[model samples]
Target: MKYQDSLEQASEKAAQVKVFLQRAGLAAHPVNYAVCYDYISGHHAALCTAIEHKLSAKTPFDDFIMADLYSRYLTPANPQQEQLLQDASGIVSRLTGYTDLAAEQVADYLQQLDFSLLQLQQQQQNGENILSAVEQLRQQTQEFRSGQYQLQQQLEQANQQSHQLRHELEQLKLQRQLDPLTGLYNRSAMQHQLELWFTEQPGRRVAAIAIDLDHFSRFNQDYGSAIGDVILSKVARKISSYVQSSGLPVRAGGEEFLILLPDVDLRSASEIAEQVRRGVEKLRFVSARSKKALPKVTISLGVSLYQHSENWYQFLARTTDVLTLAKQRGRNQVASETMLALPA
Candidate 1:
């Protein structure tokens, strides 16, 4: 219930969020997505002010800065958890105080009893009373120790429950960063990974391949969205299969996808892209009811190496331009930045 937007309004905002992320070259990671969504909503004045300040200063958006902004502004403090911890601490403090007081009382009583024992040896009248007091003190000490043990167990359980709650929250946040239909990392996640890769290895060689399903919109229009979704999922899986463990595959909205290859050259990335194109082209979908083969699918790809001087968005834009050139020349082909530089 955190979001109150109707279906139409939410869809509109989601589209805008994509555009915003694309423009800023930010990942659609949960933190970045939340920040973008809230900013577009125009509801959080302080958040808006902070973002505007960064923009005015022309500060580039990085994962660390985005995470800081999210932690500072968007992340809601768990009041219940805070109160529980405080209450537990208070209990521990009080228990310590009581234990100290009990120890002092026991010490004083033991001292008095020892004196009384000497007196009892002389008087032999109140010996029974002193023994009875000692017995009571021993019983009280045992009961207090038992109570402390129980309280310690309860505190541990509460800590465990709090940890579980936090883990669940983290899992839920991660889910939001995935493309629901394609089951691939969304645009935000792609951005986040790009940032991390560059941060981990400064000036690392990276190749980006931008992919678009050829004539997908036309196919979607001819067939229903449900069928189109099936194709999209299959294509996503095909693209992901080629990436394996060496690269990141992302569903960059609509019928577009991206593959980011670190430690891979442009030529190697192009070969992989070509393989994906062939793989997707080879996949054959059959109509469930009619038992007829569906239309053949193909993809256009653009490959580029990350330039040291360029930001991720600029790199993506240039790659996309190459992809655009492929589409313009003809669909279902591979294009590279070198080709893009050539005279038309």
Candidate 2:
């Protein structure tokens, strides 16, 4: 349904999609087919860009990865969430109107009370009229105080509702931004963190370390996906352990992960990358069913500095290219921008 290609265009793209699926050893299932079709058609800029990076790096695509891509980019928003969002917007608007109206009413009441006070001062010699005016003034003041107290109570209630709404929204946002398997940040969260860092301090240096588990697809094939998932989760935790609170650790689909370090230089990032690589290499896993030791898991990492001139995707792409270089030189190694400048 997402595709709107003409018959001829669809045919051409389908052919290309076939070739891509064949190359990746992925079956032409609906999810995989749609993802490849989207890529070939050049629609869905984000999906295209992601596929391009993977292709450039010769990363293997599997059923899980294909499904992930579709879910992340092509899947429709939850209807319930959409309805909730609309309701929240309406509530906020009404709250704003109520607050504005309360403020105006209070101001008008204060102005009337001031006029009454002035009249009382000027009519002081008219004792009976002054007394009557005083009584009127006292009643008006009491009404104003009571109204003010009521509005304050309403405002407090509104604030509480607003707080609760925000908390719920924050929880929802956190869920959306996290990878379900690894419990790490997802690409959307990563992009947002990058944007926030730049927005807060323009031209601030951000170091990116792109990491990929070497031969992870083969591992999944050998050990089965369930085991692969466990490995992924553990490795994610190990990677996250090294990143400070200032950094963001992300699961960038499949076996790929990215660490973003704001205000960090290339040297420090590379060191962190090396530490992550070594830590993953040191990890040992055993099959739950067989009690046999599994193959050692290792990671290849690429470190790069973000350039102010380029978008986050471009910066990530360059870092991914460096990761490809690490893969080329040998897996379980580190590559950097300096290496990017050198010959392959």
Give one digit per residue, the lDDT tens place, for model 1 in 1-344: 24799988998999998998998887787778888899888889999999999899887775445655775688687665566567657656766765676676667657766765565565456435456555655776676677667666766765676676667656655765678899888766777888998999988999999999999989989888999999999999999999968689988767889899999998898899899999999999998878988999999999999999988866787788788888987889899888976865
Q: What is the lDDT of residue 103 in candidate 1?
A: 71
Measured by TM-score, the strongest candidate is 2
> What's the true lDDT of residue 82 in model 1?
67
Steric collisions counted per model: 2, 0
Residue pairs with backbone overlap in model 2: none
Candidate 2: residue 287 lDDT (0-100): 92
What TM value does model 2 have? Answer: 0.69
Q: Compute the lDDT for candidate 2.
A: 0.86
Q: How many clashing pairs does model 1 include? A: 2
Off by over 4 Å in 2: 1-13, 16-75, 78-84, 100-144, 196-205, 262-267, 289-292, 306-311, 337-344
What is the C-alpha lDDT profile of model 2 across 256-321, one tens digit per residue?
899999999999999899999999999999998999999999999999999988777678878888
